[model samples]
Target: MPHVNTTIIIGAGIAGVHAAESLRNEGYQGQIMLMDRDSQMPYDRPPLSKEWMKEESDNANILLRNPAIYEKLDIDLKLGVEVTGIDSQRKTLDTKDGSSYEWEKIILATGTSLRTLALVGDDLRGIFYLRKMDDAVAIRDHMQHVKQAVIIGAGFIGAELASTLSEMGIDVTIVERSSYPMENIVGRQASAYFLDLHKRHGVQVITEDAVTQFHGEGKVEEAITAEGRRIPCQAVMIGVGVIPNTEVSVSQLEIDQGYVVNAYGETSVSDIYAAGDCTSWPYQGASIHIEHWDHAVNHAKTVAKNIIHPQSAPYTYTPYFWSDQYHVRFQYFGHAKEWSKTVLRGSAETDAFTIFYLDAQDIVQAAFLANQPKHALPARRLIQQQKPIDTQALADVNIALKKVPRLQGESNTSV
Candidate 1:
């Protein structure tokens, strides 16, 4: 291994913290520093939508590692430091506070930011977007006084937050521009169950309703829909979507909306790697950029290994995502862009079932389920190996999913 003098990682989120830990595990005795623009310690971003947003004190649980771990591991933690620019040729970074640091290698773990809608009254008070700890705190505080919360964009985050607010005795309304919530990720059918779930939980779900503008005096009192319907609410939670945090300063390094990386997390600039939501890399069947929590941790591991071993293993990652909404635990594995055939292994109406998306070849491309994570295990393995299974056995709910035999010795690389 080439000697690395100093390794500096930007953004002390899951990716940065895990990369530092992985390096130490691999016997790297170099100076490791994690920098975050936020003042808090490295923390898990998932809880921002659930626990952290409900109870203010719950932020303690989100820390990636306790303070002792950083001291014990000898990681130089630099919180509240923002990297304003990256100089690839000089192998150095400039911070917003007029400071510069040189690094032997740099890992960009700066995750995505929330993409707010450009509505007419977007600047109105009580209009919020949740993506950071600060955002969560503000939302939580406002929820304590507000009786109703209207969430725009019915994605996972939006849905989860709506469920959370509903559980707290707050009236919640979710407006989705799509025909159904989570259609982009979970497909329209699975998203339909999600809609039913929300309705059962007393959440008013308005699908295919686009918010044209917000209306209020000094604060957001109501949302004006495209169809000219005004929904009354004290606050608006915008969860439209996210965009990669690659800024113009690093544009020369090569980017296709995100920092384009190979299977090894290598950017166009040598010794520069990116992981987490900021990275777009090749996975099992296609090039994808996943924003799930696990991807941030796992991809950071690959980036760390690649930094030490340039010829890193191919990042054949299985796309996985989960959401905690009401009493349902929705989990998905593998990629499902658009399924030609949809098969259900169990029942969705009963709320405990798995949905399988298969291509014309009958190979399972993706699987979705609520409260049935065990079924996801085999599907994940099959997707990783790119193996084909018996379709009849897969679709039978009475049959044990694991009992299905794999077509051995098939050398198909696509899953």
Candidate 2:
């Protein structure tokens, strides 16, 4: 670590800043230059669609850390600097500002690029995407004069925006291309819960439909769906999805869905590493790219730890993320793309429940909790342990999550 002269971190979002802070905490004496293309100070992103959009945040309280803290940590915070190229062999970086810097190590925390629409109204004035702080600010300002809004997609961002805009008394309509949006994340049984939540909030959700055309003069006035539906809207926000932002000029750097990295966040090129959403690291013997706040924070810390002392720690934490829509908040723990079946605890009807995604062997792969605070810790622990679960006991509200692994019975359990 003493030989390490400088550590250049790209992208100053949650991952980059935390990586800098974690480097200091891990006793890395090297010069840490944190850079981002964004001019704004580092801010949390989850609130951008929910809290920041719903209310007026004067760019003060939205900060991820206080302004003084960056100075205190001696992290050279470069807000508007964008790295254009990376010379891995020479260990130097070229920036868009015509600046070149020599670095012993580099960490890529570039995050993801927000997915945008390519329809006829793509150039419309009122069309927007929510990814950065400034995007939310613009949307918030325009919302004052907007009477109707059409949100495309039913993912976390789109759904959250629909809820916030609808609560503000603006007519909100969501056009999702999938018959059941978010089915891949929450499964079909729980997917119905989300639709009902939006419907109850008076959000006109049009499923299995995609916006094909945008009709307007200079600004957007109406959206034409693939299903021959015409909807009038003053503003449009798209939340389709995002792809990894891997734009480094290095040709040899391995990339599969994201910048390929090891468990210790070491990239293919020596002295170069990557973390957060831009990295695909080995997890449970499979390479996976996770784009979530919790993953970014924890992965950055682990990368920092390894940079300070190589192979000292590995990122093995269970994946987790949360979404806030309307008055309800949903917290999901672990990751399960496919499961044998979803074991439900409590009732989705009662607005509180936990869905466990178990494999064929009845092992806990992941769990979804809707306003279930008591089960959060236990569910996380169970998922981490990867122990065989008793479906009946797990689903039974009487049996605690921690105890479900211990007591396995064939008896049918009811909420």
Give the top-scoring candidate (lDDT): 2
Task: For candidate 1, give the lDDT of residue 398.
Answer: 75
| Candidate 2 per-residue lDDT over residues 144-221, each given as its tens digit | 999999999999889889988998899999999888888998899778899999999899999988999999999999
Writing each residue's lDDT as its tens digit, candidate 1 over 1-415 gives: 3235688888788888998899888777888988888998877878888877767447668888998999899889999898888887777788889998888888888888888779898898898998887887788878878888899988888988998899889899999888876676777778889889999999999887788998889889999899887899999999988998887246568787678898888898888888888888886546777788888888899888888888666676787888998788988898767777877887887899888887666677888888997887877876665566777888887778878766644544663
With a 3 Å backbone cut-off (N, CA, C), the pairs that clash in candidate 1 are: none
- TM-score of every prediction relative to native: 0.94, 0.96
- What range of 10 consecutive residues in model 1 has the weakest lDDT sum? 406-415
Q: For candidate 2, what is the lDDT?
A: 0.87
Clashing pairs in 2: none
| Candidate 1 lDDT for residue 309 | 81
